[model samples]
Structures are given as structure tokens and as C-alpha cells.
Target: MTKYFLQKTLSQSVSVSGTGVHSGKQTHLTIHPAPENHGIKFRRIDLPGTQDIPALFKRVVDTSLATVLGANGAIVSTIEHLMASFAGLGIDNAMVEVDDYEIPIMDGSAGIFTQSITNAGIMEQTAPKHFLIVKKPIKIVDNDKYVMVYPEPCFKITCKIDFQHPLIGEQELTFDRAKNNFEKDISHARTFGFIKDIELLKKFSLGKGGSLDNAIIIDKDRILNEEGLRYPDEFVRHKLLDSLGDFSLLGMPIQGHIITRKSGHTLNHLFIESFLKNKNAWETGPTKME
Candidate 1:
């Protein structure tokens, strides 16, 4: 007899603290366990009145600078890393409480968040985990950027990138839920940007908390960060990680093969919006574990 995989949440509360990559403000975040099917939510403890924001695709207020969820004048930015951790670890439900408008940008990756969730432990709930099963091919294209989700029996992602830099001309990564280790393979991949872009972004008051400590800085002909690279294709891997986080906003895991090419947050959000509006495109059901 086969037993179905159950939905899971944190066994105890865990916290992470750091500065928001854009806000540059010190932020404290805590993840508390929720009852079965509660899904994931963010509460702004620093806000005046009610400040709860459900981490759903429909509630996503901004994608200009990280995935931002806002409601009732409360906004939480830079949440992709934390959301990635939950999705990567198959955490179905949690109540995230934050003391600032943004979640901390720890190492510009999901590594720290994954570690915290691990330390808190994962508890399985009696309810079965539901997955969004893609029934047909759904795609969104914007000039050279593209995003697509295809009907498949398992969760998988294939990402391709082509940067102008010679060092990172083109990169591709394929992640299979049954074959890939998210924590070691993708969670540690740091966000990256060109040196000139960083300087320009700083002038515009963005990436205030960005540094070598949190991101991989690339020079015109060389690398700025002495650590070199975690993986030769770390940039593409980080994009994959971000996509996972963005897709997590669907409020449940999905069973499909997601293929992306030169897509960023905007394209990712657009795809989600289209995917949701198309009623015949997907259905919810229990996942079959191998």
C-alpha cells in the first residue's frame, strides 16, 4: 500500500534577521507553524492596525523590487528567498511575522532561511498536500523573455539565461524534484549583478544593503567578489531559485515542467496571472510521490 505525502509546517518558530536589500533597514522575521491548509502568510508586526498579507499570487502588489505582498498599508518586500525555502523544503503552511516592511536579504539566497527552517524542524499534518496540475501548455512571452508551464507528471524546472557578459554568456539548468537537492544545489546560489549596474542602482537608492557579502558582483572583464563563484552556473541557478519562490505564491505546490528563458520577476508574475485566469489550464489534486 502507498501512503500519500502529507502537508507539512514548521514544528516551532524560527527567526532570521538582516537588512533589506532595497529598504536598507534592519529587519527581523519569524516563521511560526500554522494549522493544516492555513497556507503561508506574512504579518507586519510593525504596522499600526491589521497588517496581514496572504502570500498568494493574487495578493502580490509589487514585483518591481523583489516579490512584494502588500495590504492595508503593510508591505513585505524581498520575500523570494524565504518563500523559496518553504517551497524547496515542501513546507505547506506557516505564519511569517516581520517587524519591518521587508524580509531580511540573508546572503542574497535561501541558504539562511533553509537553515532556520531546518533548525525549527518540519512537522507533517494529517491533511494531504495539494498540487496544481497543469492540464495544458500555458506560456507568456515578452520580446526576448519567455516563461512557460507544461503538463507533466512531476515538478521540474528548466531555466536558460543569456547575459551580455563574456563570463556568463549563456547558462542553463534543469531541476527535477525527485533528482535535485534544492538546499545544496540551488538554495546557496547568490544573486548577482554587474558592477556598473550596482553603481547605477545605488545612485537610484536601490540595492542599499547589497555588497559582496550578500551578492556576487561582476566586473566588466572579471569578478568583483573574491569567492569567485559557488557554481559555474550560479547565476542561472539563482534565477531558478527565484522562480521557485515566485511560483510558490500560487499558495500550493505545482506539478508541471516550468521552462523559462531570460525571464525576470515581471515575466514570472505575468505568467502566474495568466495561469490563474485560465480556468481550464490547471486543477488541484494530491501529488504522487515516487
Candidate 2:
């Protein structure tokens, strides 16, 4: 198979250590190259004998605060960023080992993971790559929010967010994998939250490790980060970044155009479930590389 159409894994093991955004505890994650067809799986090294958790839609257990995967009573929380990093770079198989239940929220963006993986390099495997090619439009609507996907020759995303806040009223981004660079266009756009919601998140056992250092914090009129926004539309870009990671749970790349409006982890998961159940909407197989 052509290298571009073949599966890929990391060329060497890579590791990162930091604090969990929700747990507020230090955690270490290591990504190791895996054989073809192994797919991306996470092992909780902290809990020996627990079954490995596959990074697929069926494995997701929670999306309240972050995308969480669980199996055999073990879990790995806050995995979207790392999963997005792998998807953005076209990695198909790898073994992710973590010493904590949650993956560290490095800089609150996929930049750290993307850069580390890029620096270590990706290795092409013997097996051909597979893609979930959209055959017909599939849509999921929740009151005013929605997620939809249409047939496209290559992957593309259009995300729109409207918080109705004074600082961030509305933002939109259209990212085509054919032309956009993930690291430059989307990876650096950090996850953001409003100061007003911190207490609510804490009551849910989340956001305990958040700080200006890892995320963009907003007040009524301004962003509290010493350095300002990475892009004027970083909010929308980060939303697109999240959708990219959430969609990766399909267990393969996609050949489609995905559009989202005010979507979040929960909505994304709902859409995935609907998409899977409506099997006629998509087909799985190798796709030609352009």
C-alpha cells in the first residue's frame, strides 16, 4: 500500500507529565508504537489487570466535563486532546499508558501532544488505512444545537459557537484537512471557560486544576490570560478542535464535511450514536488519497 494510504503509529515512545484539569493530580502519559490494526487503546498503568480501554464511541462513559473512556471498572478521563492529536496527525494505532485516570490537560490544548508526536515522528504501518466515508447526510438536533455530516471527498469541519457573552458573542471556523494545518490552525486554540462557571464545575468534581496557565479564563469583560487570544476566532477553532477529537471515536478517519452549531462533548456523543445506528448513512473502507 502507498505510505499515505497505510496505517501509522509513533516511531518512538513519547511521554508527557502534568496535572489533570479535573483531578488536580499529577499524571504521566506515554504513547508507544503499536502493530498494524491494533488501533488506539489506553491502559491504566496505575491499575494492573484492568482491561485496556479502546478509544471508540462504545467505550465512552462520560461527557459531562470531558470525554471519558472506561472498561473493566477503570477509566481514562479527559482524552479528547490526546485523541485529537492522534487523529490530526493520521495516527491509526498506538498503545497509550497513563499512570492516572485522567490525561493531563497540557496547556489546555492539543499543541503539546501534537508537537511531541510530530517531533518523535510517525511510522507508516503495513496495513492500509480505513475511512468512514459518508454516503448520505446525517443530522442530530438538540433544541437549538446540532451536528451534521455530509459526503465529502476529504475531511472538513465547520464549527459555530454563540455564547451571547459580551466578549465572545459569536464565532465560526471552516477547516478543511486538504488545506489546513492542524498544528498551526487549530491545535494552539486553548479550551476556555468563564469565571462565573468555575464554581458550578467544581461542584461536579471538575475544573479543579484550571488556571490561566492552562486555559483561557474569561470574566464579564475580558480574558484573564496574560497573553491574549491565539486567534481572533480561537473560540470557534477550539470548538472545531473538540469536534475533531470527538469524531475520532469512530475508530477511523472520515471522508466527510461535518458542521456543528453550539455543540459540546455530550451533543457530539449523541450525534455519534445516531450516526452509527443509521448505518446506511456511511460505509467503511479504504479511501483514495488526494
Candidate 3:
């Protein structure tokens, strides 16, 4: 049988500071190496008398604006994007220590995390890396929205989003995990939102930490940011990036082809749940490297 259970790796202790999209509060996050099989755990230094939160799908408390995970009365908010970066980089284990409930929305992209992890370097231990590979077609659909995963030897994703705005029309992005360059292709893609949501998000105190520096804000006719789009299809690219991060919450790398359409965190979580429920549809194995 192929070897399974790849050894876990973690970043050398490094810190990242930024503002939270929802809390609008400045936050500090430190990444520290953890022992094998520890997976990814979050510790909130801001709260008192609460236990650490495991970054697991079952603990996910909210997915409306972002993916939030809670456990033992403590919560970690807005984690999908960073978690995706770790997943894409094949980081199997680490401990995240933060001084706030929400992870800092660094540039609203995974580039910062990617850079930090690369700087910290990856260490392969005695154990092997584990992956959940799809064995059969499994699908989840909500009304007209849907996401599906099919058996594959490596991770792959195709995302299609249609905003129909003049600035961002329909766009699609695809990446084969084995062939794609995570840092060059996916890391810099920033999260995006419509101009129409700005007021609503502000009223809810959500975008207090958002700015052109962190996100691509588009009005009805054009992008408000003077910098223009990072890529011609950046809107969908960001969605694919977010999906990668959200899918990473599965607690292991996935070997499969995922197709998503107009889905966000909510649908992402639902898809995870569906996959978990149909455990027979997939099996855990070691990730194959080229």
C-alpha cells in the first residue's frame, strides 16, 4: 500500500499584525510549530478562561460573511483565506496564537501568510501527510447553486462566478494542485465585494478594516480602486482562492476535482458537511508529490 500519514510541519515562530474585517480592531497573530497530528489549533489570547479552538468544520459557527470556528466557548473568525494558504502549501500542522477573536485580514489575501510560511520554511517529520481523496462523485446543491467533487489523484478546483457587473462579469478560474504554483498564481488574489454591499457591510460594522489596500471594491460600472484588477479575471480568481481556504478546513489536504458555482462560505461549509456525511465516497491517503 502507498505510505500514508506524512509527517507534520510548522512555521518557525513568526507574527503578523492587521485589522479584523468585522471587529475593526487591530489584532496580532503568531504562528508556532506544533507536534505531529496536532493539526491546526487557534488560541485566543484576548479572551479569558476559554480553551483553544480547533480549526475543524464541525466547530464552524458562522459562514455568512466568513468562516468562523468556535470551540470551548472561544471563537476564531474570518479564517478561511489564511487556512487556504496553509492548505495550498501542504502545511499539515501548526498552532495559531492570536490576540483577538478574528484573524487579521492581511491584505485580504493569502500572500502574507504564504510569505511568512515560506520564510519559516517547511520541515517534513517522520510521519507522512494524509489526504482525503474522492472515490466517487458526490454533490451538494442548494437551489440553483452547487458544488461537487469527483475522484482524483491530486487536488484541483474550478470556480465560476457571475456578478454581472460592468466591472466584473462572469469569470472562471481553474487550478490543478499538482501543477499550479501556489505562490505565483493564487497567493496574491485578494478578496472582493460589490460597492452595493459597502454601506450594508459598514452598517453591520463589518468592513471597518477593509480598504482598497486589502480588497477590490467594485462599483456598478467600474472598480473604485485606482490600482485596477490584479488579473483580468481576478474576481473569480479570488473566489477560487477563498474556496481553497474554506476547503482546507476539512482538516487535511484533499485529492479531488472540485467544481463550484457562485458559492461562498455557506455553500462551502455545506459541501464539507456533505463530504463528511458521505464518508464512504472518499478515503484518506498520503498526498502524492511530483
The clash count for each model shown is: 0, 0, 7
Q: After superposition, how far is residue 73 of candidate 2 from its true place, in Å?
A: 0.4
Candidate 1 lDDT tens digits, 31-105 = 999999899999888875775899999888889868898887777888898999999999999999999887888
The 10-residue segment of model 1 with minimum total lDDT is: 43-52
lDDT of 2 by residue, 252-286 (tens): 99899999999999999999999999999899998
Candidate 3 residue lDDT tens string, 1-290 = 55554665664787899999878899999989888888988898888667878888888998878888998778899998788878878787888999988898888888999899889888877777788888999889988789999987777999988876777778888989768988889888888888779879898777888888889888777787898877788788888989988888898888889999999999988999999999899988676555
Pairwise TM-score winner, candidates 1 and 3:
1
Off by over 4 Å in 2: 1-4, 203-205
Write down the TM-score of every candidate. 0.97, 0.97, 0.95
Which 10 residues in a row give candidate 3 its minimum summed lDDT?
Answer: 2-11
Q: Between the candidate structures 2 and 3, which one is better when assessed by lDDT?
A: 2
- In model 3, where do residues sit more than 4 Å from their true spots? 1-5, 287-290
| Deviation (Å) of 215 in candidate 1 | 0.5
Q: Between prediction 1 and prediction 3, which has the larger lDDT?
A: 1
- TM-score for candidate 2: 0.97
Q: How many pairs in model 2 have backbone atoms within 3 A of each other, for residues 3 or more apart or on separate chains, i.e. clashes?
A: 0
